[model samples]
Target: MSEPFPTIRRPADRTQMILLFIVLTAGLAAGLAIYSSATSFITFIRTASSALFLPILLSLVLTFLLEPVVSFFERTTGKRTGSIFIVYILCAMLLYLLMQFIIPQWQSAWNSLQADLPRYIKGMTNYIRDLGLKIEAQTPFIDSADLVERGRSLGKDIVNTVIVGTPQSALRLGGLFLMVPLFTFFFLRDGSRILRSCISLAPNRTFEMVHDLSYLITKQLSHFIRGRIIEATIIGIVIFIGLSFTDIRYTGFLAVFAGVTNLIPYIGPLIGMIPGILVALVDLGIGGQFWWIVIVYFLIAQVIIDNFILIPILISRYSNLHPLWVIIAIILGGNAYGILGMVIGVPIVSTLKIIFIEIRQYRRTFSLSERLPESES
Candidate 1:
């Protein structure tokens, strides 16, 4: 028994230790390099300012979103390329319809609001005065004269910015206008090929792992895209029908604005409401019959869509990602590449998660047991 109590020694696999160290060092170096690159002001500006990439990203997003439809076509037609062509044709038709029908109506609505700015501003001033009186009555000694003045100033700024400053701002907006669709087209066409080329470069042993990870990334992206588009379409249609039934002018335009704005998470509905409510105010004036009803309609529509429709159908289908992580990713992405980074942050992080999980699972599955000493046995 004493002889059998031999020393328990740790394995001295120098190669594995060295490899691990090398890998860790390489990873650290790569991370630092990326951080440095991202933090560079010039790089950030260049990426943010580039109009060319936006369209490609949009196209890729649309492609990912429509990939399931494309897959269905592929399965039916037995041709991936043909399905891709069909998807593009569909996209082109949608864009053409927007340009032909939607944009003109939106422009007319915007122009009508711009033309009636003075009346809206006057109504806003009276509303502020009424609110001030209510506040004064509630607090007795406190006067809301300063608050009313501030509200008036803000209203004036809003009107001036919209009517006067819009032309100058259009220059900046034009960048996004050109970039999104341009980037979207190429991204859709070459996205799969790019993924394939990337996977092919991985080490042979890791090839299967990479392939699996890639598939997972595609699946998640596809789900997110499809879910979001479906949710948006449903919301848009519902809002349009509701507005139409309620006799709200520019219902189609408002609905489209809401649908498009809904693409942005958390803040989108609020953003969409800004233009819609503002336009409604201009159209109906302050004391008009439609004013309160329209406001109530918007509030109810938003509540129902956000809670019952959007959350239930779209976001609930995905894994519950931590809000904290999502915020961090957005901030980091915004700093790294501005709007594009912000747009792609969640998807990129999700893809990375897939890769990490795949690697971890691979290790767990492939792990071998160590041999024990004979004496110990």
Candidate 2:
């Protein structure tokens, strides 16, 4: 009996290989199907989420950004709701004062811009035409009559966009902004309970993991928001100060544009810098020493401060996102939601990544973790 050889089991390993092959084949099929339907899914999601997207997103971000302030006030007043109200009142007053100063200056700059837009457009087009072999010569294939008609149509559009678009956009934004205070109020007042109620839908077995993920994401996301505000504020103030030292017209306007554009992540600097450069080119023409010096100094100083100082201090370690991913996110966000998308994309992606990592870690720690009911859990 002791000498008898034990049976070697080859079926177990073979069965596992077969099962893996089936699973991989199924996954490939599912992936292909998903790729095929991606456009429709995106359209459905975009349409469905468009209505309350900004409102909800803004509210959540404000709530997170203001959390530390709220907590500090809470420690003083010993009441969460009262602290939220206090923060809101302070915010409201600040916004009112800021808007009063900004709106009038912006209006003057806008009117001035409307008067100069056609000249800028003409100069830019001439500059474009000068760049032979660079633009692929689409203008030559097109008839002069067609070009003139298109130019007129474009000019009208430009005028309308500048004159009509700005105020209309501001009004639309104002209306959207009106919802923030109300949403922020209720959210700050009862956000924790609301979040908990949502999380309570998960099964008991996975409650800890879900809760931990939420906490990790919330903390990081809030930090990201605060860092952005601080970074934008610093850059804006610095730009304004630098531009004030220049002979450039509309320094206030240019500085404001620069700062506001900073909210759009990597693409923001180029956008913000363009108006100043254009104005300089139009004002001083090409090869003006003053224009070159001012633009170069302004851009370099801002870049040095932001990349070396503000970003390293505020975002790099805290955000824990790769530069490549940040760029990708900005592109995707811009494509999906324009400027606002670029602004919020990093935080959203960071939050999602943190959640995924936490879930993965939990599963890796326990071999049988996947045995639990995923949906119920």
Count of backbone clashes for each model? 9, 0
Residues 168-246 of candidate 1 have per-residue lDDT tens digits of 6687568656665555555555777888999999999989978976786567667666676777777778777766755
Q: Which candidate should be chosen as best, given TM-score against the real structure?
A: 2
Cα lDDT of model 2 by residue, 198-286, tens digit: 88998999888788778766776677777877887788777777766666677777776777777655667777887777677777676
In order, candidate lDDTs are 0.68, 0.75
> Clash pairs of candidate 1?
54-180, 55-179, 55-180, 55-182, 55-183, 55-184, 56-183, 56-184, 59-184
Candidate 2 lDDT trough over 10 residues, lowest sum: 142-151
Off by over 4 Å in 1: 1-53, 75-82, 94-104, 140-145, 160-185, 278-300, 303-306, 317-377
